[model samples]
Target: MTDTLTTLRAQLLASVAVIDEALKAVPPEAVQLDLPKPAAFFDRLRGRLWPRMSVSQVQGCERILAACGHAGFGLAWTAYVLATAYHESGYRMQPIKELGGDAYLSKYDTGRLAERLGNTPEADGDGVLYAGRGDVMITGLDNYVRATVELRRLGIIGEDVDLAKTPERVLEPAISAAILIYGMRDGWFTGRGLDDLLPRTGSATVGQFTKARPIVNSMDKAAPIAGYAIDFQAALFAGGWA
Candidate 1:
């Protein structure tokens, strides 16, 4: 179901409270991860999960970390968002265009996908126009419009910006970072928020990472993404994310 502004606002406030409590629940000295081996951790992540992982990827994660703090998300929440970007962007850790041409993307223009995406059934190229761009690959007209609304509500964007008009703006690093966190945190892309995935806010176990997959899409790559999330959790800890 499409979320009304009021409904979204309510979810926003509730998620805020949950995040606040979740952040507070962490012990001040809790560094559950191993020693702060920043270099080795990076080596492992880069060598295995992302062979070409670069400084840009780390910087991108740092940006998301900053947004997580701005949104009061704890390590678990932030790590999941990072891992999602890892999977969605194909380890680029940067905004990338969704693959596929008009014929393929057009499937989103009419039928169940169109209804879900809140696009018209005219097959007028909404899919091609609104193809996913950003850390998390959110697609379609309604998703873009909702991103505008949520970003504005989060104070990440302003009145001057309309994502539906300048959809490429979502590709900007800051906007992409904000979209990843906000969409997953408040369930903009899907009605299932982080609260739905974790048994407790900010305390998702590794297995639960699989469930969080629904925040963006179905369990298309849940296992691999979950592994990525676990690795990210460790790497972020190594990078002093706690």
Candidate 2:
């Protein structure tokens, strides 16, 4: 067990090194290719949900953005993603279970949540097992299955790691980042992609930004999330990333 833990730690360090190298390689002309310093990021998040963003969490966000850029996400997509994370995790930079997660599990054990998430009536513990998790709050059996399949296909998670079975794995920073990025970009979370609201041109009016609420939740915190997106965009612009 100790050996396994050691190996995992070594692998994590190697992954961090790789991300650092990649960030270094980013060309100056790339749109908003830089990450905010940890101090700056935390200061911006002060009095917000996650004022104490950890060094590791900031690194995770940076690595995720770097990977997204490599995958063709530009300034707009990056800002939108940051906003989504801000809303979902309150800038915590980690996968967090939904507020009232226990209540949600109990309430949805065999009700609407179960049905919507593809949990059969006989799947007694499905709701509790697959309740909302991850940076983007992947909820339900169907979404978990989709996340597992897509992450596997993208080579983000290993074949040995069954995210559907081990939903907690969604909290792993790299894995969660991949899930958030791919899910939002490809509409895996819902049938609505960022492009549906923001457009490929990376421009979004107020109405269109608000429309992105459906991409994560059903307009629950649409206005606030959109406002967060606006703040993120302005920060990106100030940093010459947008």
Candidate 3:
């Protein structure tokens, strides 16, 4: 038994080392991009989308983009992340329930939605509580628990904070950004990473944007999200970031 435990420990350490080496291989340029000011970003995206975002929310959005870029995401990936946030948060730059928020809560309080979301029949109210949060709308009990564990592992959230129990914490910009980038890149949210959606084959393309819907939410609102990605790409180019 002791030997078996030792072998498992060695394997875990080796896995960690492999991840560290992979992170080191990311080029500095890949993780760095010129970010636009909040006002500039707002001006460029206003009327077209994010009509409800305040200047502070715009700043939060810029911060999320810069954080993703600095974490080794390229332009296309960053734009997709932005577009996902735009749709998930209703262009507010904060976590929010889907349209018909209360209705979603009430309906999903039980029934098929609850079951599909991994809310056991005994775990009453789980559906409404863990509906969706964060930039990518981390939904369901399983995802909330996973997010809490992963964020704790990344030191982005305290060990004592159970995101499953307190879904509101997912609304914080820094926390949401960390969860968004990590979840999307690592396939924790949808079992589909950015690479699964948009391959890193040189430059960005319109096709990639159109195809990124399944990476986040299914086909729902995919067209608008794709349009937002295109808009973001154009904005990035104009800002000299792309």
Which candidate wins on lDDT? 1
Residue 85 in candidate 3 has what lDDT? 83
Model 2, stretches more than 4 Å misplaced?
1-57, 101-103
Per-residue lDDT tens digits for candidate 1, residues 48-96, read: 6766667888666556666666666666787788789988888878888
Q: What is the lDDT of residue 36 in candidate 1?
A: 49
> Would you list the clashing residue pairs of candidate 1?
none
The parts of candidate 1 lying over 4 Å away from their true place are 1-41, 199-203
lDDT of each: 0.78, 0.73, 0.73
Residue-level lDDT tens digits of model 2 in 1-242? 99999999999999999998996875433325355453454456545535465776665566566656656776677767878887788666667877775655765568676788877777477777787787788888888889989988987677898888788888876678788888998889768887777765555655667888887777888887777777665555555453
Residue 72: error of model 2 in Å? 2.0
| Decreasing TM-score order of the candidates | 1, 3, 2
Candidate 3 worst ten-residue window by lDDT:
29-38
Tens digits of per-residue lDDT, candidate 3, 1-242, equal 99999999999999999998986985443344466543465567777775565766665576676777667676688778888887777677666555556666655566787777777765466766877777778777888889889888887788788988778887766778888888888788678788888855334677777777777766777777888888876666556554
TM-score (C-alpha, index-matched) for candidate 2: 0.75
For model 3, the superposed segments whose C-alpha errors exceed 4 Å read: 1-33, 36-43, 50-53, 98-103
Return the lDDT, model 1, position 96: 83
